[model samples]
Target: MKTETIGTATFETWTVAETADAFARDEIVLIDVRTPQEYMFEHIEGALLMPLSFFKAGKLPGQSDKRIVFHCGSGVRSERVCRAAIEAGITQIAHMEGGFAAWKAAQQPYIGTNMATGAPQRAPA
Candidate 1:
């Protein structure tokens, strides 16, 4: 992981392969920083929506062991969220490289459309 300091906070970046592997192993919390509409259109399985517009630091899931991986349509929003998370005292944080687009380009499996909305879904409760 490469570290970056934005202001006084530090964050890391992870490649699509790395993030995917972590997800498959249940070793990370995937946060999608896109709007609910975008998320409903397509998103990685098990990813929780934490849209940048309404992201709340206190609401992030507490995970001491599993890594927190944030992602967006193309990574920009996720980077913003990562910085916020770091400032909020989240120590283990990372954003996916190229974001969801890269994940899809890699042919990774994701949930979307009717499959994703067949059952009502909301951000983490």
Candidate 2:
């Protein structure tokens, strides 16, 4: 895939399988850039909660050298977050092509939290 720079960050989009492979190899960081409510509803396995609002507020944490992958309900918000990350001087980042919906559609496992119980549930296979 061709690498592009939105600001200071360099990002490359990827398919769900490619993202899974990267995660398996521990080569990338999966960041869920959706709202808290959406994240609580469902999200990719092992994804870190770094809402777009946090990025906008300039409170995102982590190393710039790590390969960061941003995702949301759809690719739109994540794309915006990716751009913001670039503007914040993060150099390595990317967005999932279709976001969490695509990941679930691809039969990838995800974590679903029970709002009432505050318990985490894994997507059934």
Candidate 3:
């Protein structure tokens, strides 16, 4: 992964394949920064919900392991949260490129919603 560095933050844009592989290996903490409603509809399996609305660097989970990755419906909010973490002194972080849309597009399996019953469903079939 090519690391993107700015004044203070050092983050990387990870592809869906890379993200999934890392998650499968337990190499990072995958976080979903989308709204609760959005998450309820669909989300990455095993990803922790930490909506951008109230996201705080100190509140982030799996910081001890040193790999916390954020994602949203698209890349926008996740990147915003990444910058916020940088501003809050967490310089090293990452966000999934293209976010969940890209994940689905790449055919990476994830937990999705069954609109008819509003039940969670595993997808990519």
TM-score winner among the candidates? 3
Q: Which candidate should be chosen as best, given lDDT against the real structure?
A: 3
Question: What clash count does candidate 1 reach?
Answer: 0
TM, every model: 0.82, 0.79, 0.92
How big is the RMSD of model 3? 1.5
List ranges where model 1 is wrong by over 4 Å: 5-9, 114-125
Per-residue alpha-carbon lDDT of model 2 for 50-72, expressed as tens digits?
A: 88777652555565556777788
Model 1, 67-124: lDDT tens digits are 7889999989998888778788876578998998888888888875656447643322
**Over 4 Å off, model 2:** 5-9, 56-65, 113-119
Q: Rate the local accuracy (lDDT) of all candidates.
A: 0.83, 0.79, 0.88
lDDT of 3: 0.88
RMSD of each: 5.2, 3.0, 1.5
Q: What is residue 38's positional error in candidate 3, in angstroms?
A: 0.4
Deviation from native of the Cα of residue 102 in model 2, angstroms: 0.5
Candidate 3 or 1, higher TM-score = 3
> How well is each residue in 1-125 modelled by candidate 3, as lDDT tens digits?
65988787688888888899999999998999999999988888899999999898887654677498899988999999998888888878999999999999998888888878988899975
Candidate 2 local lDDT, residue 43: 77
Worst 10 residues of 2 by lDDT: 56-65
